[model samples]
Target: MEFAERHDLLNKTFTPRSPVNQRQLFSGRIDQLAKVQRAVESPGTHAVLYGERGVGKTSLANVAEQIAPIWNSETIALKVTCNSNDTYSTIWRRAFSKITFSEKSQSVGFLSETSINTRSFAETLPQELTSDDVENALQRLKKHARLFIIFDEFDRVFQASSTLTLPFSDTIKSLSDNNYDITVLVVGVADFIGDLIAQHESIERAIVQIPMPRMSSVEIGQIIDTGAARLEMAIENPARQQIVKLSQGLPYITHLIALHSFQEAITNNDANVNKGHVSIGIQTALDEWQASIKTDYVKATTSVQKKNIFREVLLACALAEVDEIGYFAAADVRSPLREVTGQSYDIPNFARHLKEFSSENRGKIIERTGQAKRLRYRFNNPLMRTYVIIRGVAEGMIPLEKIR
Candidate 1:
């Protein structure tokens, strides 16, 4: 391939900043996709896709919307993203606007002619909206086509007003009770479905909860392989394994590092990507990390004492083992802390550091959950966890060989 062609292929294959809207570019989450397919195929059933940040919830939702019509030829999929200022009525208005409907009219003249007009579904919605209003509009539209409405970033609306979810809950219940042919998919960042939607027993059975976990090593490798194959490039085993370890199970990290690694190989005029390229990729990924994340890391690790342990402690926290939801107990940090610091450590040694990390004074990089002795901690942003680990390797605190 020519130089420009390779660069173009690189751009098209790796998209760290954007969600994968095309099914061909998306990887993993087969089970999540299956659950979504089932929900879309079944009437009066909706789905909620929730997970920690950077787990590709939006990408899954996007691909789901694209493929839903394939699963049912009559299905019409529409999506609307939520913002902090969005309310229940505004959200539905945005969703409905994506749908275009047609109207036919016949002339009364001798040479009678038929005229077709197209308009947005939003035109049918009333100014003062209620769950009944939404249900009624959807019910009317169902006569022509089955609807699949995706409410992406739903957590933003919920965070703006927890009460806003009440109307959505009411709408879901109404639709299910009436056996409407419409499905609603709510996508957002949350450990539990309740974090994104209002808890209502009436709509409990009407919705399917699809929790998206981080990609596994094998799944992450598919992303690397698929992208490399598209460009007709080869990524050696060691380089592929390094990217997976550095990614720490997040797809976003994989893309970021892989994009740079491919670029590095191309610059060196080598079609094969190796560990040296991956090392450069890691450096570039950290250097180009978002300002907010860098700021938070500095805040979480900065200290006044000469013998500061904040940085080491934070790195230990990053290397700590986390459960399915990303929560880890204080005990989990001890082993990693000992490894990072080359010293024996216990809960009391860095208890204050954990408390400070969860406080606003330290940017609240890690969030504290549970209570008393049973408390667990997790990074407020999952990407921050990956960032911390990469920083460790970059600073020699963590050797590349020790990644796995």
Candidate 2:
């Protein structure tokens, strides 16, 4: 392929910094997509999609919105992202503004179909909004038309005001009770459903709780294979396995590493991407990571003494086994620590380091959960965990041969 053509193909195939907007570019998540489709198709049913960061929650929501029209010709899908400044009234107004309602004039003797009027749903809403007001306005819409409203980044609204979710709960309950043709999908970064929606008990029976875990190795490989097929590129088995294992089940890491590996092969005029290309790709990924992540790593590992174990402990924490929500206990770190240092270790040896990582003094890189007797830890940002592992492998603390 020509130089410019390969560059274009790379750009079209990989999206590390953006969510998957087109259905053709999306991969995996078949079961999650089915649940979302079912929610939209069933009257009086809604959905809440909650998961850890970088797990592709927004991408799923985007694809769900795009496919709604295919399921029903009269489906009107609308979406709005919530920010710290958004209120219940402002959010509804923003969503309603995207809806354009068309009205036809009555036909007369000589002026048949004189004109048509078009207006946004926002114009119909009163200045101050409430659950009853939203329900009444929605009820006025054509009975045959189905409405799908997706509120992305809903955690931002919850962070701004815990009470804000009550209005939404009430609105959903009202709509479900009346069997309206409206479906609401809430997408956010959260470990649990309650973290994103307060007063959810009232609407518990009305919505489906879809928790998006990290992608499986098979699913992550599908992303690489799909993109590589689009570019007519071949990836060696070792390189492919390295990317999948290092990705640690996060799609963002897969895209980042795969994009650079493909670029490395193209620059070398090679027909296939190999292990060497993956090495260069890993280095490039580390170099291009956000400054904030780098800073957080330094803060967590820096020490005044030359023999300090902060760096080793933090790396062990990265390699530690985590549960579905990403929480890992101190005991989980002991095994990885021993493997890295070839020395016997215990919780007491690194417990203080773990505490410091969770403190503001160490940039709070890891968050502590549970009581003192049964404390568990997880990285404050899921992406940070991936960064730690990659950095470890690059720096020789984690041997590449032992990654999997």
Candidate 3:
């Protein structure tokens, strides 16, 4: 029975995790997947992945591990994230744990090389291991088998780069040049790693590199169908187009918006997802984007990015309503953004963001009709713009619509 018919059935929304249900919502990433598969199968395949945040970099890696078994090789994938506390010792210990985790290790033959003499490591481990201790343990572990250690978000260790407790570059190099049975994969997007590489060329050579690509509209539709399928909710045709356009063909955004829309509809006791719920979800997604910008975007901490992103998107969403406005361009609404932020950004930057969701990029502005190109720069997430407009009005940054 349809959700509308079964009033007794409970409603639930999906949650975001490391690897989103790609099979369900995973869209056009076959080429990307094949590239990653090749990396995992190759020995000592060290790679650096770069993409807009939420572009499924982590999911790709997770998927890489899942498909590793298909290839004829003993693949043990250990995924550990790097952060502020990732000292040399912290890295090795976490690397050790990830490497040893039964979920990954059991599939492949990963055993400590040295005598199971955990006496010292055990004695000192409960307390955080300093950089020195980890380096020592790593040297000891070197004797055993070839290990593939993946450090996700490796750029989070920006501050510690100058004072690295262990010679990270040298270690990876020694293992690689020596062709030790060890490999390293460092993944991040914070840009610090790329900058760090310029400063230290040798470390750059030790690792292989791979950058994840964005999703296309067809792929995004697949994600929407997958997400809706899970809820037993089939999206109306128009809603799918709105999602694809609003999400800018991003898998993560697709999943996020779809999940939020489903949640909104279920929460409000709606029978099926319609434009109303999608509107609400767009707002929620905007709020999340605001929170994300505020989290580490210290430069424009006062919701600077939020303000602009929201302003342009909000205007477009409002503009999208008029029937003649079948296709609205962002350039059609730049004035609103300037008014909202009280300052101008690089028009090129703003224009680029029309396609790229990141604060640094501009949203793609498209003309709905006519040979004359419609001009506009809207945000990738309509919700992001909505959140900004609401907050701006709340902060007295932008006046109410009636006043505007």
Candidate 4:
């Protein structure tokens, strides 16, 4: 059997309810999915769906149509991924491409088609469209069903270009405020967009954020059972136990683990996927994690030495396996870092690196308290720290005092 035929994991080839521009696998997050459905169906409002990577944020955007059939059976949703490369022209073209209209968009009616050009649109979009022959094209759109858009990977687009702020704030922000019945949903990592929205008047007025919560274990079990039944194979007890222990109810990791175990099982010619396969998958996962951290660390960062400097302070975070909420502190980290680096760092440089490392890790490092004095450092992902510690990429989060 081919890999697709034999590998029965949900991530491998799970079926979505509808035909979409991108492939989507809906495994869990019934609750979060339901919330997005409510927001989309509510009408007269816009929302931002933000979350960590590989946590089904984009998939949710793609499969969000699943809820449409329930509400009106005619609700139309168009999803777009925005990155640094996306511009006024690109976004307009994309909007024209994804959204349908009562009449063909290409047939000119009023505004000059030249004004629809990227550079022109960059300066004056709908305003230019109003003056150009393309106004007829846009009016044709109003004749169609109400348009809804979801922008996925929004961070990549914002981070990719520096000059894009004006175009972005104008195109997307304006789309949200135009007083049209169209609803816009933007989905991606939450890091900078929150502040970006706060800065823009139109953005602040038009947008409402609806964050996706982390996965829960009960829902995870349902996904596990669903994936297994679809595969026509049973998960061995040992594998099940190991997955539950390691996954911590995280959906992406859960699917990745399940897929890896299934592949290992098929390779071994075993009908049942067991802990041995899970153990191998776990090790492979850690190795991949180490490599990924190294790559991103190097890209977003300059040197491992620089990364290591901060590591000493975050040593307490590197070992924390499960920080559900809250964080550890830079104060607790300073002395240990000095101990590791074999040198003393003054408070100023020390504070800079501490904040820098926290910025580097961001949500991965949980905040223990809202106040600086009360704040503590916590790993955003418990398992990622565990992976780093096992690979010797980071020092233990457990203070040395506890080793005694």
Instruction: Kindly give the number of clashing pairs for every candidate.
Output: 0, 0, 26, 22
Task: List ranges where model 4 is wrong by over 4 Å.
Answer: 1-4, 8-11, 14-25, 66-70, 100-140, 162-178, 199-206, 288-290, 294-315, 319-327, 331-386, 389-404
Clashing pairs in 1: none
Comparing 1 and 2 on lDDT, the stronger one: 1
lDDT minimum window of 10 residues, candidate 4: 14-23
Show where candidate 2 strays beyond 4 Å. Answer: 103-118, 142-144, 195-200
Instruction: Write the number of the candidate with greater TM-score, choosing between 1 and 2.
Output: 1
Error of 1 at 363 (Å): 0.8
How much does each candidate deviate from the true structure in C-alpha RMSD? 2.0, 2.7, 10.9, 8.6
Q: 2 or 4: which has the higher TM-score?
A: 2
The local distance difference test score of each candidate is: 0.88, 0.87, 0.55, 0.55
Quote the positional error of residue 381 for candidate 1 in Å: 0.6
Ranking by TM-score: 1, 2, 4, 3
State which candidate has the highest TM-score: 1
Candidate 2 lDDT over 1-404, as tens digits, reads 78678878887787888888988889999999999989988999999898988889988989988999998878988889889898888888888889887887777787576678999888988987877777777887646478999999988887887667778877887888887888999998764367434565767888899999999999999999998888888999999999999998889899899989999998888869999999999999999988999999999899999999998999899899988778999999999999788888889999999999999999999999889879999898989989988998988997867765
Candidate 1 stretches with Cα past 4 Å from truth are: 104-116, 195-199
lDDT of 3 by residue, 1-404 (tens): 46454333222223343455334344567886666555555554456676655667777666655555555355555668788867765666766665441121233346634323223333445456654555466566656544556677776686655555236655655555555545566666635555546645775665556666557778778777765666666777776776776554346567666767777777776657887787777667656764543332232222355445634434434333222213355554455556655566544645544444334422231222333355433333333433344445435665444222
TM-score, per-candidate, Cα-based: 0.95, 0.94, 0.61, 0.66
Q: How would you encode candidate 4's per-residue C-alpha lDDT over 1-404 as one tens digit per residue? A: 44556664434543322222232335666666666666666545667788665456776777775555555556666767776777545655565566422322343677634333233222333433321223344445545665566777777766776554565555545554545555667777777565557547667656677666666656566556666766666787666766654554556566666666666777777767777887676666655554555454343234456444544544434433333332445555556456456677665666655456556353224334357655556555444544434333213333322321
